[model samples]
Target: MGGTGGVALAGGGAWVGSTVAAQPAAAAAEAAIGGLTTPPAYAPSGRRPKYRRATWSQQFQTSHGWNAGGTGTASANANDTSVFVRGTQSVRVTTNGTGKQSYVRRTGMTAQNMTGKMIRLVFRVDDVANLSKLVFYMGSGSLANYFSWTFHAHSTTAANYVQSGEWVTVHLQWADVTSAAGTYSISAAGSPSTKTGFTDMSFAVYDNAGGPVTYRLQAVELVPDTATVFPKGVVSITFDDSHKSIHDLARPVMDSYGYSGTVYNIADAIGTGSFLTVGQMRSMQDFSGWEMAGHSYANATHTASYPKLTAEQADDDFRKLREWLVGNGFSSEHFAYPHGAFQKTSDGVPVDLIASRHFTTARSIISETIESFAPAMPYRLKALTGINDGSGIGGTALSKVTGAGGRLDRCVNSGDWLILCLHKVVEGTPATSTEIGKAGLTALMKAIDDRGIPVLTVEEAMASYT
Candidate 1:
């Protein structure tokens, strides 16, 4: 589960073998999260730049089997220096019979302490005989962890992680290695850097087999902690089919706690007794943090009659509903396919323009946790239905609120959105209502407030993704 033995070089260039103990945990765990009182502010430094400037490069020589290649470069800072070596001009060696090695240089760097700062390294590989044992060395001549994907491979092996003939970006965060906080971890991006120490950085090309192999070096960069960007967690809630009970029973509880929710409105079903009327939807849209999104013009069942509806029919229905919402003073940027039914064109493109104009994010029954997928993926919201009846809302709602099975508790801990979809909040009867009465709803709201997770409407959540 851990890396093979390696070495670490202290600030004065003293080397230590891989027997060093792990550092203590950082203080971040003890710090309190202030609160989710407001949307996080965007500091100018957090923004990603449109284009990056090359800083350094190192190309590998073919002595170990690789052909000669040139290394290019880029960086976000001008004062930050790095090194470069290309295959055509440098020495190459072979590790065993299979891997290749190359010569590297350190230029434009000054020795300085980099104790708390975050450092990043990127490498580019044109080709590789095998990628099993790639490693990196700092200015102190200590080898960092081998560049393998054993821990992050999901289900694959580390040896199979190489992408030959294409640029691969690897990022290495020094903060995680140096601190107890686990704040830093190494990752790769497109190219390798030539920077060294704290003042200037440099990069070198080497093969796992200690022999030479040919490959191109694009660029390398050493970005400070302030220059790195991290994404904020996203939370989204959706209510299927604007059921009147959502407004009559759920609305009051949500509004009282200032919780926001998205109501998926079925155009033709609006006036039905069990469903919300068009007028009710328009009013909900006017409320703060509440949003009205399309579920379909008539709850079209794509699984049954998908091919029957022409492209124009589907487009027209979507367009009309969007126009109705916008003309009635609602945000027109969200929509959910009715019953999660959708169509794909002959070329695999969605027939409806919902994917084009308005819908920024779409939700499917993907997973229970938002962390399960990439943050950029459309959030997968889970429905808390009768599956957990024995222990879910069926148990004491207060116990459920503070316990593991509680929806709100899971959402807060995982930083994923909790979207509660309720049908008929019955006046009586445990079977129909799960017996989660108004008191239960109140208790749930209090738990959410105490946990410090902001409750925003679906529109608010979608805005963050777009």
Candidate 2:
């Protein structure tokens, strides 16, 4: 139910007893690997590092000397104590309506080697509608020599959509680089990799919606890519909104591949328009072994405005939703934010302060990266972009779905959990952007199987973390 819907999310493989008389061959293979009651553990490949520490960080304190791009304006104020995630002040960037690339840039620094490094940025948008792509740039002092990596903070097609006026953290990995020029990617001359160092940095939010827009930056850090490869990675297929098409279409396909998924259902919407009925969910749960999870209350909007609610209100909303799930004989151990919107409460308490008290694991559609085995924030697990017509293996044929640029390879090579978000599954052409054709779903499952990766439910994947 998020905006980004192109890539995978979390999980590999888990087992479920099917009511179908003809058990899938994949099921037997999965059972042989102990996928029946428990997820199989793969030994770490030890080809990559296991720890990550900040190599460089910025707090926007003092005279940071950041400048705006093109016709935009940018400044840092020591006394601007309005919103600060780290310190007492933050950098404020205002875009001019004329600039296509509105950004804040700072140069004149000693070159820092960023090979195999990831960039982290914490920021907030005054109006999400005015923001296009969230881009990060690294340069070798010369403006012409740089690499740009884009994050999905505002992309409507991406799974992880950061809400307006809410603090969001984005991790831009090396592979996220969309464009590079000059010495950014040296021609096979670097020792470890062809990637070069950077002496300049820029944070950008595109102004695609016209008019001047404002955003704030709290912190930025350069960290090592502590992701590692395992003997086999895991994939968790997840469906949001309890769309009836998922049960009528996706479930049978996944069952054929010996995979059961986690369903985040809106409690109040059960048996409502286009939603799965409780009886249908029961069939999937008891017969297909699907895990029923919480989405939100029935009358809640597609996206939750948690930051607008007081801490007490947020807690009540979350509690009622969980209670609805449990009261209906569903597991309330996990939850997905409605439309992937989560942030601090209106009273300034972090959303996790309230969410952690209700659910064991909280998943957010934020990061495009795979969730680590031991996630840094259990309550805010990163999910890849949604698997939809535009972003994921949806609407495409099997070959294109398992193309050379598939995201599943990253999981297979990194031993991390990839949580894939899906909304609707249709047998014919998709009528909406949220729907993926049956062929696309089948292709994705086959791709995961071809790589010999296991699929697990969210619960199974979290439990297999050890």
Candidate 3:
């Protein structure tokens, strides 16, 4: 009555559509004789040896060209034994002006079962123009019918692969595959770097004759049913002044990739000519994951009012700004000192009266990691510069926290909040850059996420402290 392997017996008359006839006498006797055996014993609840789930993943490194037998031809290379399992057919490669081919088969060796799996491919290239292609085949097809993922600019023009050259890593993820067609995703980076979002993707490689082609190839890894969680950590990216570019250009990009930042608004600066409007500030406050804090009224000149104003005068200024913020539907809990300057008494209590009442916490400019500074008051930490600048944290900047035991590393080790203060997000600005951009900030956030710290806005972080 069931499909496929259904059992049927001879009927006395014509057989009915849904019914099965009785078994013969000899068949019934054999079944009854085999029913008295004991079942096998098996362990129920004991621990088995733990093996890495990643062992089934595959990795390949190729230096020599795909040419086999020292004869330059596009044919199967027996000596060159680089193989890919399913969804991959022939390896059509061109290296140093010469073309060659190799075949991937599951013979004698164990082939990786990557059905419905997440995989990553990292490719390292020597030059940018040297083209390398990886052909993927789903059904029984020749190189003309398969999809070719190619990488263009490569450094080497010879048979031997160069090590210290520009390389790219390609990531491929496979989903469902059917008789009709299969689905997959791919991403490529200049080096062996992992990214959250991918672009330049051509899905469903339907061309059949070398479908979608990418440039370079380094290494490929398969992550089978594994969950990659971003580590938890606290990273504070603060931008002083109502810099709309930080919000308009940087914020969207940050949010697009799941990151949050704090924008410190100088109360008097908003709605002024070159600054963000009050409406923009309010919009940022209502932004799903962003926070707006105070950057002081008019970014008060340090040379004029500071180091001279009595505690009372400072308190009045603070109260005026704090009341304005609250009236404007903004939180007055977090404040950043103008010019990174704050008046302090002999005992180190901030002399500004508003420091005691209006603000929950304050921050100042103290670049690099200094263990002696207190985290509770006037949180002194490095401020990020614009991207590519030698001053911003991350990247090739030695002044920033790119090296070992840098500011970010120290902050992680101490489990302290690392607040990065910035004046502007525009280029050609002091303590900032024009071309160097928020990508550095993104990198820093990723680093913090990697180190297992929780990133919170100024207001959110202040709430925890309180």
Candidate 4:
């Protein structure tokens, strides 16, 4: 079996139940094969092997690979293709204009017990507003037992209503389809027919809002478990307060070590004093890469009674922020509560609105109090220690977040997601009263790089969890 959404559906499958801790791919394999609940396996101490064998890396560079079916028309889309990055041919699907305007796409495959294999599929949706929902499934040729999930390409429309498709490249990391889908309810335990086992792939889309939608399937292949299994101690170094110093000082330091960062901006504060200018934000993206999330619309800095914002007020705050972000070539998919404080009023406002509706994540001001270490369910509620001004007075030291070296060392060694939160990246002034000094920040970045772990922006790292 192969695998792996939000309403606005997770390109990543939905988190059905309890969120598990970060475990490596190998450990994930052992646990899935054995039982639903089991302790993690021995994590690797050093580097993972680079070599990989594709049980079958079917490069759909040409047509006529497998049988294509459905009410839609599947044709080789050399016109709209990813020739450079992903071979030549991309299969384009255009469904009929029915009420529940959708399509069916299935291709027969050789029968094999794909129980614990890490199944991977790749595709993209065009810039069409009518594109409502797309789902992929795996099952026996007869469509007896199957599993399905939704994916949205954050793309925009004619009126510039952007929806998860600035040309989204969906790399669905469906780990061990068995565990992902759940215990196979109906199975052919002893059957040996060619299509007896789950031996076919089906792709379908449901009721488009507008007319008909055309989505492109670049290619879909099954990856070895050793390839894309397990979670690592990923580092999402997020800097709050759109401080100018972040773009001026911090970016260079992080780039020097091949690292990137996320900024929780006060939409109303850009181009203002000591705040990030629009040009600098774009430059960081061009120079290296960056992520921008909502901090607050106007009130990035907290007032005296910070923790007590009403739910309606909080919604209004985030809404303004989202508007600014969307209007500025960005999607308001992430948010960081101002003052690093999480607020959920009993009337069901503020944090609740941010959590359920507004943002995908609500990062924590306090690192230790955070549930687990990294990539937890209320993932929006991440734990972060400071690197610069995040002194032990309030949040954990930058050193603590970096495991102070050994602990940081072991954190990566054992494969946990470590998110280091910082404010400013300053130089001379020991403004221990505020931001992190350049020296300490430099050292922390170095230690993190030495571990050979991937440094991702907050949005990028979230993909690993599901």
Candidate 5:
């Protein structure tokens, strides 16, 4: 699980790793992801930007002699043919129970500074039956200092993690990785900003299924940094939970920049507590060109997790929420999972399957990175953590909004999409991870304006790009 902010929003998390012995090759399946052949869009028509080869790369075609760690319950096998994104084999790891930390480790590598580099992983989850989470780590010798990120495996909110038997490509920025969860902890000196030099790395996956669950890794690489500038890029500014402060504080700043964002409104929270009233939403939608999207149905406090509901209950909730939004004269084509939790029900029904019945797209707080224009998984649309006033793994300082700006810059440089998630906006100072101060919001809007990046509503982006 990623680090959650106040209420339902979150900050940071990382991924999984493992190693296995070589076995006889199996037939390679044709690549299911079509975006790979799409030439890197970060360069000009005639000129190609050069990217230094990966400081370390593994194809998993044969045994890399990496060390495996975790309880005896977990194991990995290489040269597996059943699932792969490239080549004829991948490393498959099977495990049961949560926090088992099943992984393969590669140590004694030449030290490399990963300041501006990106971690690239190609993996697949074929069964969501008992899966809970995936975690990855990098540290120095003797496993003393390190940082890691977690990926939710049980969530049906993300398309890539669904049991669709498709390989997904994920590129994680150095800044997005954190040691928020997992049995192994990240020390202050182990954080990404402070710990750039590394001698070892590993990937691990944990399951809550009680039975067996498996995930396959085709490749892992550390792509070196390069100067990039794509011909075009787009950003979608989003406010979740329908907080009244969004209308009272954030809107004006964004409007001044000629921007319009999407608001994910809890159906039952309108006009109650600190949430936006129906009239306010309408004004923001019609007068400000904002899009009103669906969130949880009966979440009056706007803190409910949909995955906790029974499949029948969740389906009814989605239906009623969409109906309420459309009946109130707001677009219901887009949605955001409450608390960023869209894991499947105990019966193995993915929340996305239900969401697709009501909304065209459902956003999830999966990571902090630029989303692909052609998202491999639309329902579980990946997003950066909420923007806030604190300083740490997931907070942005009000005095310097460059962190937010850097994300926009990455989108522009790669011709990708950036979906920024925020919860509430308030006056003076923000007191929680779920809230950003007015000054912080204004500075972020200014950063977007200065970059000259096109700002689109969720519906607009999907209609135009997907």
Candidate 6:
């Protein structure tokens, strides 16, 4: 990599690479997740901006890729740093006593989309007494377009603080980018320093310790906050039909454990006498664990499966439901098929193409458990079995939902999404065929939560991958 003072400004088109291939959890997975897991509670962490790595070592680059620049002397900080996690080398820099004026930078990172994402830069100062401030950036335009600023905990007061000594991981969350592409302020830390709304095209590490200090850029990695953000495999628990059992029985249990589930609501059923009322639907947000997505504007009246709905009907129903939910303050563009079925239009078209046009994902359970490598196929996401497959009766064992010892654990080990599908959560007994009792549902969610995998709404699960 060569350091040429400034970058060659490219058009906004490079951002496409950084755009996440957002597939719906089981819509691709809904069809598949018939399952999703319950996420674990975040450990204690405050002040530090918490986040999870959307990516890590696989994308972590070497400091050798960086270019030398500034009054400071920059080189492969190889002598001082150690190779960790995927054979990557670190950069070492010796500052020239001038803060911010000295920096080692690397340009051309079109995939570093910092929009709703966070990037972590981990490093250590050989001498904490001498070096104090650190800055990591992403932007090819100019210093103003940078993303990360200060990693020191002393204050957001942008630099002149001491957080040195051991290996420190600094995280930067991108708020809104400045309207003027090239405008940014290397302002104080505590004060908001927002800029760079575009895709990251370059990265740079600056020494603002205020003097000549040598520091090792051990790793510039993306780390997720164990709190709020998830670390590994994903899960989603989907409750179809806005069933009263979901709000009454499931909600309390999920909330008590700090977990959440997705509820696919049928628009026409809102405010009905027996189903979730409009007030109840709106109030579901209070639990903060349930995601209300679209089931169908009007509940399925006939034996029509996905293909039964014409393109126009699918579009209208899905679109209207999403709009209605959003208008009612629900966050969703996800959907669920009335029957656990996926199909193609009459002329050999995957009916789910219509979902891609209107919803994020549409759900169906093509198989008992999803293929680990196949979660990305948004429209055909496979589902796991709640009751033993091939049996239509309720007397079957609820092994999938309850995990049956290590069943859910095996899925997590293989990195598969165990999208658990269930109908109602009853008290003493399951009210219907596919419904799980309260204790069974709680135990199922608990088992998944114990595994430490993230439980995402179907849509949230897809975003986690993309």
Output the number of the TM-score-best candidate.
Answer: 2
Q: Please, what are the lDDT tens digits per residue for candidate 6 over residues 1-466?
A: 1111011101000000011113332233222211222211221111111123345432234334555466554444433323222234455666665455445565554444332334545454555444534545555454455545443323232211123332333344332111222454432211224423333433333445555666555445543322223333467788777777677888888888787788878877777765787767666765574678777776662145556665455555656666777778876656677675544444323455455555656676544224222232344455544442223555436663344323354444324455666667778666556777787777766777777777777766655534
- Residue-level lDDT tens digits of model 5 in 318-354: 7778778777898647889887776664444566645
Task: Quote the lDDT for 2 in model 6.
Answer: 19
Stretches off by above 4 angstroms in model 4 are: 1-232, 304-307, 346-350, 369-374, 389-395, 402-407
- Candidate 6 achieves a global lDDT of 0.50
* C-alpha-based local distance difference test score of model 3: 0.40
Models ranked on TM-score: 2, 5, 4, 6, 1, 3
RMSD of each: 17.2, 13.8, 26.3, 18.8, 11.1, 20.4
lDDT of 1: 0.39
lDDT for each residue of candidate 2 in 174-276, tens digit (9 for 90 to 100): 4345567765552221122345557788887777746667777766777654343334557788888889988899999998988899998887778988889
**Cα deviation of 50, candidate 3, in Å:** 43
TM per prediction: 0.46, 0.65, 0.43, 0.48, 0.60, 0.48
lDDT of 3 by residue, 146-264 (tens): 22333111223321111222122222322111112222322221111122222111111111123222222323344432112211224676777676677666676567656667776
In order, the Cα lDDT scores of the candidates are 0.39, 0.63, 0.40, 0.50, 0.62, 0.50
Writing each residue's lDDT as its tens digit, candidate 4 over 17-103 gives: 011112343443323222212211221121212323346555445543544445544333433343212444555666554525243
The per-residue C-alpha lDDT of model 2 at residue 94 equals 76
Worst 10 residues of 6 by lDDT: 8-17
Worst 10 residues of 1 by lDDT: 5-14
What is the Å distance of residue 310 in model 2 from its true position? Answer: 10
Q: Least accurate stretch of 10 residues (summed lDDT) in model 2?
A: 1-10
Ranking by lDDT: 2, 5, 4, 6, 3, 1
Candidate 1 local Cα displacement, residue 385, angstroms? 6.9
